[model samples]
Target chain A: MVTEGREQERISVLGIPSLGDRFAVFETMVKEHNISLVTPPVTKHTLSLGARYSPEFACLPFKGILGTFIECLEQGADTLFMVTSFNACRMGYYAKVQEQILRDLGYRFKFLRFHSSEKGLIGVLRAIKRFSNNASWPTVVSLFRLAVAKLRALDELEREVQKIRPVELEKGTADRLYREAIGAIDRATSFASLRQAMRGYFERLEQIPKDAEYAPLKVGIVGELYVVMEPFFNMNLEIELGKMGVEARRTRSTFFSEYTKWGTFLNALNDEKKELQKFAHPYLKRDVGGHGLESVGEKVRRAGDYDGIIHLAPFTCMPEVIAQNIMPFTKEGIPVLTIACDEQLGRAGMLTRVEAFVDLLERRRIGNILR
Target chain B: MRVGIPRALLYYQYYPMWRTFFEGLGAEVFVSSPTTKLMLASGCSRLIAETCLPVKVFCGHVLSLANGCDCVFIPSIHSVEQKVYSCPKFIGLPDMMRATVPECPPILDPDVDVNTGKRDFYQAIYKLGRPFTRSPLKVRKAAETAWQVHQTFQRRMLSGLTPPEAIEGMFPQSVEEPEGNGSHPIFTIGLIGHPYLLYDEYVSHRLVPQLREMGVKVLSPEMVERARLRASICELVERPYWACEDEVIGAGAYYLGRGEVDGVVSVVAFGCGPDSLMIEVLQRYAKRLGKPFMQLTLDEHTAETGLMTRLEAFLDMVRRGKRPQGISPPASWSQRGGSKRGSASWVYLA
Candidate 1:
């Protein structure tokens, strides 16, 4: 098929796990590029598309991606824009492998990387213009605005995390408000109203009692930082635990970077000083993987405080993987639950697992005042 | 004076070093053996049910070493950089293991002396060496020599050289790739997994050959350069917070998007942390690109039949250009997709 004057080119894009309001960015990019956005149908078929190609041990995200591509094929998508990085972990080379596999299967698509983005605004503008071909300049501007709005809103929400974490209000209540606010923002029109809505939401969020007496169990959520912060990405997990009457105390939050960084090393010296100031305890040594702070947290919890501990993380996080290798011998012998959440957890299943975790905590421990 | 070492966590990497280090000081080092099914099961039963697999494995090793060693060595490991963390269980392990296995033996968890900012590791070693010989200087000398030996060994491992070679004074032969018959659909498949799992024949159930049967070539991270991997990542998004896991994810995306390799397989130990995030990210990327990807979460109890069945299905689907037998994925996919070609004449070198 010979294309005419402006070369009416078709381009396709894929969506990975929601990194918060990135869709607005894509929608804008599509219009600016004069590209028709073809979202692969997300169904059991798409998952099988991945299962057919992916190794069985891979988590749900791989399957979800494979599924999307098959859907795109059925929808007549031509090019697949793959964006990612190589550092941090293993997902960097994912696009290349998937592309090869898709090619082998006779699905033809042009693969483009965002590598050219680093060349500055000119390079970015040139690439966008290359894709946008027939699109008007105003169209590109509008798209950028949408992307900007989405990013701004997400950045604002994450900054207010202190309102939801431990030493603040009840864990679940703030999340409840946050989710409600986000959902409302989706339908909101005026930017002023969205701010007011978020404010109103946070205000109500403060109303949720952080100090709930006689809660059945208090648990600590510790693990890799990325999965900890993203609620939808991790399955609305904290809120689910709360509904079961479990007072969740997530220790790892965005706010504690300074403390976690400096304090982690200082903890060893501090523990020694605490020991020296008290009785000459012979065996009061630091524990496995150099986490004396957690040992102290365990002691505090064991002292009629939190009933259980929960370690949450992504599967590949090596450090946490090492840390998880050890924690069985706390003073309290506290029952600990380790939960790993990935993109595969679609609300219902995650809530069920969380519910079960809470139930397990309840059956094992007695009600505590601090919880 | 037996210094007990729990055969868990860094025991995979540090076992030989710590054992040799302690022994060099003339203190008998008693390292625990691998935790077996019985020990792991017992630990699982004892600990909370919600614990990650590694934590369960650690509990097993701790229980296994409880009565066997004089003092179980629990190190207080901290991140060397910002935003990095050792597994959460590690933080509370010394205390937790101490409480759980109280009678196993006395644990050695020496915190740093604030005044000197030194851990009891050297001091404790010096004290333990007293029984071997009462010379304080001699003990210090032995400790220093032992530390030097350990540092050399560690440096070798970091250099991608086998740790065992540092001691034996001989490096292993080059990693040989099996000669392949030239054929269509050449795939340089990237395999993401823990070194233990990738190297362990028993655990992975000989996954490489299984893929090779379908003409898929495997590339482990150990085989690639950091530069090559970094070059493939999409620089459009913000650089990820995690350097290591992000590299694998980004590299996999890079190669997969290159239209060179057929597919990428992420084999993970069940409950391993980095894979948790990486697998999700890979799948998300694949979804966007409308590509095929899979992750295998393996545990000690990974069944060969289960693995084989899944492998066969995935291979079949990749070759057949459709979902394989007994496999029906999500009926549709995300409308948001990855790279695609506008024209049929587009030269995609796959």
Candidate 2:
């Protein structure tokens, strides 16, 4: 509550674990802006604490974020910044609801919600400025650019890792290398070092002796952003697929690309998403909110290329619920398995489902080849 | 051609306008019967398990209409007001209906988005009318007449009539408000919820009339003026994104703050995202004002006796003038031996 010595106090920004590459970029930006950033590691304890405090029917992402926020706050985070939307999805209300719940529980912290509906980069910059204690515009701009570059490099490395995961001769090699790669990217302070780190990581990934004869089953991961991206929420779905010798391709990986590519002011412009809108037209027709349209489009577009599609979304997610219902009707020949993740979902159950789906895909492929 | 409109969701609110619009174009409009056990069973069987009850009920109506109608009209209403959107389920209702009920007739979905501009809103209406008539001028005329009828319907509600009553008055021959007992109501209680839940006799188990029978007058959000409701929500940190939620919150805030009503009862559908948040909002506000507040969350399995017992108990507490002053932990109102057919749960937040 004391504003006089606020600068002397540590400023910690809560990070979403789902944003794999963007997390590193965010850390870099915060450091450059001269603000201390604190990212509490998300664990089972975090999930429990979040689930306990959150409304019973709230989505997994909301509960996960609440849990992470509480953890960060416990570690002396004086400020919490969150991105909120005014869309049709329940996502729009999560911030306000979480803030109220936290406040009710007597947590003392400055809560700042950035409305994504705010036009262009002005909203984002304003949020950045407030978070950075009004850091110079030039400094903010430079750091943002650096973060974007790092994010791009990180995404490329992740894609390479995903590609090599299933066919690697040495099991777990891709996972181990990817972890190290993320660490390197996070530690890289300069743009050149970031590029070099990514290049080095990709080279290491390529060296993982892969079976040339093995045609790995390719499964496209589609659904809500958090579940698709956050390994914990989805119970390490991609990793599980890798262990089963299946390549998992995600639809939206480059988190910051949409905002960063269109200069600082035009952050909301998403041309790639426009193409998805077109692709999903036959089934979805329009945006049903959240990433519902994207989920449908990605599956439809990649139906021929992928062996199967796994849709992971939180329970009670309206848009994904709509998508899941319509998916059966699409009849794209690709087996689509929808996994609704929530606090009630257990690891064993999720693993069993994922394993069964992989087995089905493998059988279908084998059957096709034989025929 | 006969056009079917499911008496679910927005049908309770906009049936007058839609019926008028379709009838003006010379199409015989048929509305599905009120929710019944058969419809609920059929809906639950067809719909995805996670969707809210109203959506399932809508699916049932679609199924009913599929039997005899040429096409079912389901509007994808993105935003009814500027800067405020509807729930995602409402926006994607048409698609969900089509996907769920494979036996459903052809769906005539017209996009109604006021967020873009007024022109787009009218253009969407005209596009929906194009299939009914050739002349754009005739469509415009029909739209204008329908708008007037819609305005009149809203006026009737603002004049202190419930949504069902207003709709009944609008279509005297088609629907009728059940005649009230000659006894005058002794107490007033604000009943807040979406029109679909509040007015649907089968979903609510005739809660409005039951309250009236017990000498309590029900005041719904529909009775309040739109401007006043909007003004009342100034206390909120942000305007609720969902249009119906905004109104409910605004009206609930007004009723709770005014101190005239004995208590506020919110009827929420299970799995409704907006209602879940709004209930919290109303609970917190009601707690601050030291008012008796109870949330009746309904699903397909809600029992009539359990609901009646909770209502009777809530009313008794109100009449005794023993409103709980402090905030209480959320507690379920389920009774022993209650029918557990649906996932209906009640939470009492004083």
Candidate 3:
């Protein structure tokens, strides 16, 4: 408060494109906390940069985050925010190693990490206060509430998009509207306007003409959070499935569910995760980290609902590797296709695998109908 | 009932306790034979390509025990100490075995978490013992006796004996120690890694015997007291969460800093998360101490001849009083520098 001519530091958080306009809400929150916010869009070049400097065997999310951090640093962001988990997964080591690598590479930026488990809320608050130059708690808390509401709204919009994408008569209509909805949500400053913006997007999505006669094939997607949520990392799998006339349904989204879990103390009462554990008990007795157990649970729970399942994980991900190995023996009739993605994976190869899987599913469905 | 124990992973370290506990419950203990080529092949066939070698070998051992045992004992040990975990594979080993290995016997997995107080510990053991005996009191007595045996076994290992020697010493009638002990060796090398990687002769290509034949003494992490090893790693920037890896780091740092051993070799399974980070930390510390450090990452494709050659070269360097300095050369250095004359650089297969 005493300083007159001091410049405030710019803060940046890595954003997944599939989260749509949810990141814009985060940006608004940061700005409200009296800090400059920089949102660097994840691109192919970002992935390459992250992979280039990261350890060869590091998981995909680590490489993606590293790439984003490097890009943010280049864009004049003086502070970077990251989240770490305390689970058995490799995520706990990612922040520490990435910071070491970043420092070794001679980057001059403040690195702030928030623990995803026990100290989730406190860690975030402390980080925000420090990064935003001692912003008042009341301001931060209010902005945080707004951010959470926006995330929930964004998740609802995305869920609707997933439902309508497969049955829509005109392809890409749902995706385009989602992008526009994100922009409107981002620009809406007040609670009333935010609600209006969300309603507008939902109405627009409903307007997209549906194929009444077509019964789209439903495929459940489950895996590590980064690969499952981010389109580019998984080769735009959801959109591609929609283009193939298959509906891609995922249980977890990056923002609403995960954000709420981490941003509040409600994680301890997570009944859904408890139910997943019970379902996965027969296959995976323990949480091997990442979404390994959850992936198995999702498949087992929705085996009858979805025609097939697509299990995606980064190369060398231990937990998912365990899940992938166990998935073959689930006794559920649904066929599962496991794809391990890394930077080296080519788009053509991914498409071929996906296309082949869809063809197999289609053939199986036709054969079942004939029988 | 015959309880099958796979002689892999934590078996080298905790076999005595497991054996004693099962026997106390009136069950016959049948340990899988030493890792063999066939077992490794069987493991590789059952597991995914991305899994580490030790896990694959473990699956092989499970396959070997399929026909003979009534139930396979695969403990899902979550934490041995407060905030210290075993590898994730250990936690999920039982489930993985049940999924991959067909015709496998019923698995006996009692969740072990030392962090959750002694009551829970006894409860886990009591559950394990329920199938054998109806009385919970008998299970408690057996668990106590097993604990005592394990403690004695640990003490025996700390007194400069290998895991195999300690196991033999614990159960005198069960195993025989080879004759002709050499009074002293020309050079001593600190061999550090998880017990399974270090003690599994097939995985390590009989590393201890190979060193012995070469007039070298091999010192493993087991030789050091657990408390001493714990103290050694206190200065580390981040204490490793994996209990076994933490011990390896502790013992490795202690030896490297004390300059007691001429060289250090870390035998790790390929794609192990804990080992990779721990080795990196050890490498940095070793470099600071100007000691020769080599990390041998074993996988399914590991060839005996190539491993022997590297071991010989490393031992030869130690014999010549040549201390390695700075960063170690990459694995490709051997191929590239082989054509050049008078270049003695060897590859560190990490």
Best by TM-score: 2
Clashes of each: 139, 1, 0
Off by over 4 Å in 2: A1-25, A32-34, A119-123, A263-269, B175-177, B322-350
Candidate 1 per-residue lDDT, tens place, A1-371, comes to 33573353544343333333333334434543445666543444555666677644444454556566667766766766655442223344456556656776788676666542234444445555545553456755554344445445544554454324433444455655555665565544445655777677666755666654443456766554445544544665555555555555554322222222334421324544354323212223332222223434443444355666666645434334434433453334666666655445466776676677777776665454245
Question: Comparing 1 and 2 by lDDT, which wins?
Answer: 2
Docking band of candidate 3: medium
Sorting all predicted structures by TM-score, with the top scorer first, yields 2, 3, 1
**The 10-residue segment with the lowest total lDDT in model 1 chain B:** B341-350
Query: Which candidate wins on DockQ?
Result: 2
Q: For residues B1-350, what per-residue lDDT tens digits would candidate 2 score against the true structure?
A: 89999999999789999999999998999999988888878888886798889988888888889889998999998988887888888888888787778788889999888888888888888889888899888898888888899999999988888877888887888656465843887678899988899888899898888888898888889888888788777676456568887457888998877757878898888888887777786787766566677888899999999999999888876654532424332334334112221111122343
The residue-level lDDT of candidate 2 at A46 comes to 85
Residue-wise C-alpha lDDT for candidate 3, range A1-371, written one tens digit per residue = 62543343434433222232346656655565556666666689989999888765677888888898888778777777776665677777677777777777788887766766545576566655665566678866766667667877878888899888889989999999988887777777778999998888888898999998898899999998888877778888999899899999987634454546553443522666778898888888887777788889989998888899999988878788889889888877689999999898888899899999999999989998999
Model 2 chain A scores worst on lDDT over the 10 consecutive residues at: A13-22
TM-score for each prediction?
Answer: 0.47, 0.92, 0.90
TM for candidate 3 is 0.90
Order of the predicted models by DockQ, top scorer first: 2, 3, 1
